[model samples]
Target: MTTQQLHEQILLKKSFLCVGLDVDLTKIPEHLLETEDPIFEFNKVIIDATHDLAIAYKPNTAFYEAYGIKGWLSLQKTINYINEKYPDIFTIADAKRGDIGNTSSMYAKAFFEDLKFDSVTVAPYMGKDSVEPFLAFENKHTIMLALTSNEGAFDFQTLITNGTELYKQVLETSKTWKNSENLMYVVGATKAEYFTEIRKIVPDSFLLVPGVGAQGGSLSEVCKYGMNNKIGLLINSSRAIIYASKGTDFAEKAREEALKMQQEMEEIMSLKFKV
Candidate 1:
């Protein structure tokens, strides 16, 4: 989806929520395991239940990779279901993949062409050559890791270099790459205070924000500094919503959780945009 289409969805839905389909088999409902493909079964129900409450769905690739071939198949089916059933909603392959130039190109193909995800997360450690390949795909966004929500983020992302934080440098240097307009970024909600500074560098760019809910990132705080004129944020909530229950009512419970976030987001937008 193009950036404008995504923003339109945000307005139509009155939400900037991105439900993270980071399914963990161990954490899912026990009854789902009896199904042929537990992962996909779980995902389908969640998608159906909360698709309207969210503007995007992000399936972290690690969850599928853990189960091997069957998991990969489940991943494929999930993306296909989303594309065919809800083409308007954005899909993200939360595969933080980055490698050498050639390898990155293939990785991009796997997610952008074969799987048909609208966007894929990528690491920027390898620099422009590794990321520009993914950005080459038209209308497909390359969400580069900027400031993350993890405890270890300070190890490298915040390290001062040339009198600036490494992540700021990454954001500055990334703009110089070809097709850089297609680039989005991953800014963890835990670092809400950093959004003010981040916006200074990439004020118009979209940010895929994780670390809310289960990770304890304050939604209101993130929005206070992170939101732009277009409401440029995709706040992701994973375990908290998907694992709301491990019973037959899992999907229903998931919707309840997502609705809570969506309602919160709607209120934020109304107060911020005066809609």
Candidate 2:
């Protein structure tokens, strides 16, 4: 989806919530283990229940990759279900892929061409060459890892050079690349205070924000600094919603949890941005 399309969804839904599909068989309800594809079953229920509440859904590739071929198939099914059913709800393959140009092209094909995700999270440690290949795809987004929410992010992302943080440099240098307009950055909500400075640099780019729900990052705080005229922040919730219950009624509970966040997000929109 294009930036305008994403913004329009946010405006229409009065929300910028992105539900994370980080499904784990162990954490899911025991009853689902008997299902043929427990992972996909869990995802389908969550998606069906919360589709209207969230503007986007991010399926972290690791959860599926760990289970091998069946896991991959489940991932494909999950993506296909969302694409066919909720085309306007942006789908993100949180793969964090970064490889050589040729490999990046294949990765792009797997996620964008084959699976058809609206965006994919990418690592910037390998520099512009690794990322530019993903950017080559039309209408697909490259969400670069900037200031992450992880504890170890401080080891490099915040490093100072030439009087600016390393992530700031990444953001500025990235603008010089081709098809940079399709670029978005993964700025964690845990680092909400830094977004004002980030928006000064990337006033128009979308930000795929994790660390909001389960990680204890405050939505109101993130929006205080992050929301642009287009509501550029895609705030995500994973465990807190998907694992809200561990019973047969998981989907129903998931919907309740998602709706709680969606309602909170709507209130935030009305009170803060006047949506």
lDDT top scorer: 1
Q: Which ranges of candidate 1 are over 4 A from the true structure?
A: none
In model 2, the number of clashes is 0
User: What tens digits encode model 2's per-residue C-alpha lDDT throughout 25-73?
Assistant: 8899998899999999889889999988899999999999999999999
| Model 2 spans with C-alpha error above 4 angstroms | none
- lDDT digits (tens) for residues 50-164 of candidate 1: 9999999999999999999999999999999999999999999999999999999999999999999999999999998999999999999999999999999999999999999
lDDT of 2: 0.91
What residue pairs clash in candidate 2, if any at all? none
Reference-based TM-score of each model? 0.99, 0.98
Q: Which candidate is the best by TM-score?
A: 1
Cα lDDT of model 1 overall? 0.96
lDDT (Cα, 0-100) at 53 in candidate 1: 91
TM for candidate 1 is: 0.99
